[model samples]
Target: MRLSRYFLPVTKETPADAQIVSHKLMLRAGLVRQTAAGIYAWLPLGLKVLTRIEQIVREEQDRAGAIELLMPTIQSADLWRQSGRYDAYGPEMLRILDRHQREMLYGPTNEEMITLLFKDGARSYRDLPRTLYHIQWKFRDEVRPRFGVMRGREFLMKDAYSFDLDEEGLKQSYEAMFVAYLRTFARMGLQAVPVRAPTGPIGGNLSHEFHILADTGESALFYDAAIDEVTREELLSADASTITRLTDLYAMEEEEHAKVETCPVPAERLRTRRGIEVGHIFAFGTKYSASMGLSVQTKEGGQVHPHMGSYGIGVSRLMGAIIEASHDENGIIWPESVAPFQVGLINMRADDAGCAEAADRLYERLREAGIETLYDDRDERGGAKFATMDVIGLPWQLIVGPKGLEKGVVELKNRATGEREELSVESALARLVG
Candidate 1:
């Protein structure tokens, strides 16, 4: 992608309405724009990052044995009524009426819709265990939505529903998702800690929220420091017992922490930190199935309500969370996995025919090598171009200037480390492509 042809509307001045670091940075970097209060239109650059994050979530869900299917943004209010939550959901539900005077709503969640779908489609015990997921937009009428996408009223979410015949089966599904969440966040260069959290609104007896530690996070966590030691290898090999091993260590949100009669961890081992909640999983036995008449036949010729669990990852909010966890004073330092473009090819002297030609050739080479590179071919000053590259936070910046090109080399700079070294054109290609 060439910057001259791109639609990035970057700015040097921060908006007064933007309060948080992620919100301010997102605006200044031209990643998103506010169309309405608590709502944003994801610009091209922002959409690329969001798509990358969504794909990671999808891949991990598939690896965990969950099937994918898309659901609609608008749902019949009758579905919520069937689950006994139409009114109970409160003002955030965004109730509406169609021309026929029938009730409708922009779904905040899909528990009711998914439960009914499974009940209508699957009849026998043969379909006893199934986990279905979808990535779509959902809206909630928040009274005050701030922090950019972090608390947006309209956002993208990956919510999965698991149906099982028995309590034991639900536990297995929950643990599988638990492990998948760990792997998903780790792949995006985040260390998310699972902490026991209240079900609230979703209504489940057992629930856990995965949070990424950051000073600007909304949730305060009190946990055993050892919880942070769980590694990617362990998560990959994890089973049902993985839940026991991690949750057994003391970890709780502030509300849960305050209710503890006695602290489990010794003084030194207890760690308190602020974390942004990115994912949540719930095992609510028979909550939706029983109410919505979703039951499977038993071998004994009996009908029993299927146990259900819901897992959610804030697909859009994650962008803000990542920025919160991984940005510096310069701008967002995107992880390679979720970066919009892996390399920012800056033509420091675009007006110089030699520099422009070399930069264009390098961009083509990077693209041919299956690398995603953004070529800044705009007629701009070197300092301004460098600042823009840093603001967008591509993993690497390939600098092409007459002086460097004349020396038979180009400068390669690491965005995160600010390490710059002159390398032969071929060497630069090999390093980035590798």
Candidate 2:
């Protein structure tokens, strides 16, 4: 993308209402714009990051054998009524009345709708186990939504539903998502710890919340450092035994941990930190199925309700969470896997035809080499371009200046490390492409 043509409306002044670093930085970087009290319009840059995060979540879900299917944003209120939750869900569910006076709602979750689908589609035991997922926009009308996308009223999410014939099958399905969530967060360069959590409105005895530790996070957490040692690949290949290892660890959110009278782990191993909630998994066996009368004929010729589970990863919220977890004073330091663009190509002398020609050639070569590069070809001052590139925080930056062009050298910068080196243009391209 060329800065001259791009729609990045960056600002020098920070908004007074942006309380957190991520919220302020997002505005300054031109990632998002506040359209309402708790809603935002994702600009081009923000959309790119959101798209990349959603794709990573999809790949991890697919790897765990969960099938993808999109659901509607507006749901029939009758669906909630069928599950006996219409009145119980409260104001968070944006209930509405259609033109014909039919009760409707912008869905906050899809547990009831998914149950109805499973009930109608799987009438026999042959379709015993299945995991279905969807990535869509969800709305929860918070009375006081704050902190930008971190607590937005309208946001994107990946929600998956698992159906199983028996308790054992449900456990297996939950385990698959449990591990998949770990890998998903880790791939985006986050260290998330899974802590036992209350089922809340979902109504399940088994639930876990994945929290990524950050100083400015909302959730106060108590956990062991061992949770950080596991790798993404290890979790990707995890199994039943992996569950045993994970469950044995002592970890909980501050609210739950504070209620405990005694601690199991040694005092030396205890650590307390604040973290952002990025993902959640629940195994609510028969919660929706039994309430909705979703049943299938057993092999023994008996009708039985299928066990159920639901997994969710906050897709849009992750953009804010990642920024919270990884950034410096300059701006966002995006992880390579989730970065919108891998390289930022700057034309230090955009007005100089010779420098512009060199930059143009380099941008083409970088794009041709399969690198996602953002070219700053605007006729602006060097400092302005540098500031924009720094704020966007692409992993690597190549600066083409008139002075360096005379020496047949361009400067390559490491955004994360703030290291710069003048090297031959050929050398810079080789280092990035190869």
Best by lDDT: 1
Candidate 2 clashing pairs, residues 3+ apart or interchain: none
Candidate 2 per-residue lDDT, tens place, 1-434, comes to 78788899988788899999999999999999999988999999999999999999999999999999888999998889988899999988999899999999999999998888777799888998999999999999999999999999999999999999999999999999998887788789888888889999988899999898899999888877676676666775667676677778888888888898998877888888999999999999998999899999999999999999999999999999999998998899999989999999999887799999999999999988899999999888889888888888899999999999999999999999999999998899899987
In TM-score terms, candidate 2 sits at 0.97
Poorest 10 consecutive residues by lDDT, candidate 2? 228-237
For every candidate in turn, the CA RMSD to the true structure comes to 1.2, 1.3
The parts of candidate 1 lying over 4 Å away from their true place are 236-238
TM per candidate comes to 0.98, 0.97
Q: Measured by TM-score, how close is model 1 to the native structure?
A: 0.98
lDDT of 1: 0.92
Please list the C-alpha lDDT of all candidates, in the order they appear. 0.92, 0.91
> Model 1, residue 391: displacement in angstroms?
0.9
What lDDT score is found at residue 193 in candidate 1? 87
> Measured by C-alpha RMSD in angstroms, how accurate is candidate 1?
1.2
Residues 1-434 of candidate 1 have per-residue lDDT tens digits of 99999999988887999988999999999999999988999999999999999999999999999999988888998889888999899999898899999999999999999998898898878987999999999999999999999998999999999999899999989988998998899888888888888898899899999999999999899999898788867765667677788889988889889999999899999999999999999999999999998888988889999999999999999999999998888899999999999999999887888788888888888989999999999998888898898888899999988998778999999999999999999999999988
